[model samples]
Target: MRDKLTTIGFDADDTLWHNERFFQLTQAYFAELLADHADHDHLMERLLAAEKRNIQHYGYGIKGFTLSMIETAIEVTEDRVPARVIRQLVEAGQEMLAHPIELLPHAREAIEAVAETHKVLLITKGDLIDQERKLAQSGLGELFDGVEIVSEKTAATYAEIFDQYGDGPDASMMIGNSMRSDVVAPIEAGCWGVHVPHGLVWEVEQAEVPTSNPRFRELKDLGDLSALIDQIS
Candidate 1:
């Protein structure tokens, strides 16, 4: 498998470092801020809906999520959301954007191990500024041969990425925590997909594991990635 795989792409968020957990923390804070206006569960549902609808307009990242929080507040409060609450929402997002990067267990080692054998690319989606900042702060910036900060992860996006940086789909593999973005889509693009389960995954990113797909694989953690690659290769 490795001989066939000339390029290995890694998802930057939960796969490389801590990301969704910070978003979850901010969401809890958001619920607290809007507690007087709506129930936590209801507010969360509205926020998710708002995020999905706004993804086309705002794309993905802290900025879009912060906007969604404000929009949800307005909707839940019937447009009576307090000015202070809105300010706090914006502050919460800023705090998230400024948060420090914390690499997940074995992230660096796995990348180093893989990089020794193949071209390693950091393929992530989000606000370009935030993603680049995280990469810089992660101290793993020098490990990757390339970095792709994309707006969305889809089959076409994967295909394009492989076309530019890899030896076509058959010789590329994408590893990440999201089944939708990391596994299914890349496989559909004609590349292998590896799912490394993360402790925290956003609701929107969750999907049933495609265990039946021959090109799909799931690992308990990235620590096992090197061994898995060696086995399959």
Candidate 2:
């Protein structure tokens, strides 16, 4: 696999840094705010539904999550969600936007190791400004051969990026925490898809493992990524 691979794509959120935890924290605050209007479990259910519905409209990131929280509040409160609550949600979102980036374990080491021999790419899908901010804060921007902040992660997206940045999908690989976006989609594009499980993953990002796929792989953490590449090579 090493001889066949020329490019490696890494997911931004969760895979490289702390992401879903912040969203979960914000959501807990949201649940507290709506405690009077809706039960905790019910509120969470509605919010997840709203997020799934709004992805097409808002895309992904803090903005969409904030909007979904507001929508869920309004719906649960029979359209009587308080103005204060709305303001608080907006402030919460602003805080999220300004939040600091925290790198995950071995993120830097893994990227540095692979960049030494392969065309390493930071390929992720999210709001442009936020993703750039995180990357800047990460201080690993210069290590990547390229960075692709896309609107979505699909087979087509992987194919286009790999072709542009490396030898193409058959000679590429993608690394991330999400089964749906990182592992499955890239594998579908003829790239190796490596899944490195994270402590907290967004529900929408979860997918059934493609156990039947020869290119599908799982690692406990990014620390083992370099070794996996070497072994496969």
Candidate 3:
């Protein structure tokens, strides 16, 4: 086993701070707006499907989210829907941009504890400006040694970053909430991966929960993370 851990990569959005909750709240409002046209469950299905299909075309962030909402409204709304309904959707998107940012449970203390022994790096994916604003407001930005805000996370992404930083699989780890994006991608890239479940996961990012991977260990929250790392290290 590797005795020394040199670099640790972390996913920022849902991992270090609250994120999907805002999206959920926005979606709930959307369901109410279109209640006359379709039921809540069907609206969610259309919205989730649209999001997945538009990942490349719309990219990620509030812009994509807003556009997805608009598309869903168009698809599900009754014939000749009022202009005010469209305006309402647009306004909701703007509201999302102004949504207050909150840190996740135990984020600060866990990052602080891990930073003492590892060269901590923040690897997150989203709209550049929005993410920067969130990190700046988060107050935990100063706790990390490096912050990488990317448009997406993949095996190639991890490999390039690890190679450029002069760290390999054994001495580095990727910590985040999304199983497919965070856990699977980094581990496939040859780095240790730790899975931390979040309160809300967007339907676009949801996948089958894997129960069989020695390299992947599940933890309750950031508070328990430091001790887990200490044991493995």
Tell me the whole-model lDDT of each prediction, alpha carbons only.
Answer: 0.91, 0.92, 0.83
Q: Which lDDT tens digits does candidate 2 get at residues 1-233? A: 24377788999899999999999999999999999988999899999999999999999999999999999989999999889999999999999999999999999999999988888999989899999999999898999989999889999999999999899999888999999999999999999999999878899988899999989999999999998888666
Worst 10 residues of 2 by lDDT: 1-10
Q: Give, for candidate 3, the lowest lDDT window spanning 10 residues.
A: 202-211
TM-score, candidate number 2: 0.97
Comparison by lDDT, 2 against 3, better one = 2
Using all chains and alpha carbons, the TM-scores for the candidates as numbered come to 0.97, 0.97, 0.93
Best by TM-score: 2
lDDT for model 1, please. Answer: 0.91
In model 2, which runs have C-alpha deviations exceeding 4 angstroms?
Answer: 1-3
Model 1 residue 124 lDDT score: 93
Best by lDDT: 2
lDDT of 3 by residue, 66-169 (tens): 88888888888644567898899889888878777788888888888888988888899988888888888889889888888887888898888866664766
Candidate 2 displacement at residue 226 in angstroms: 1.1
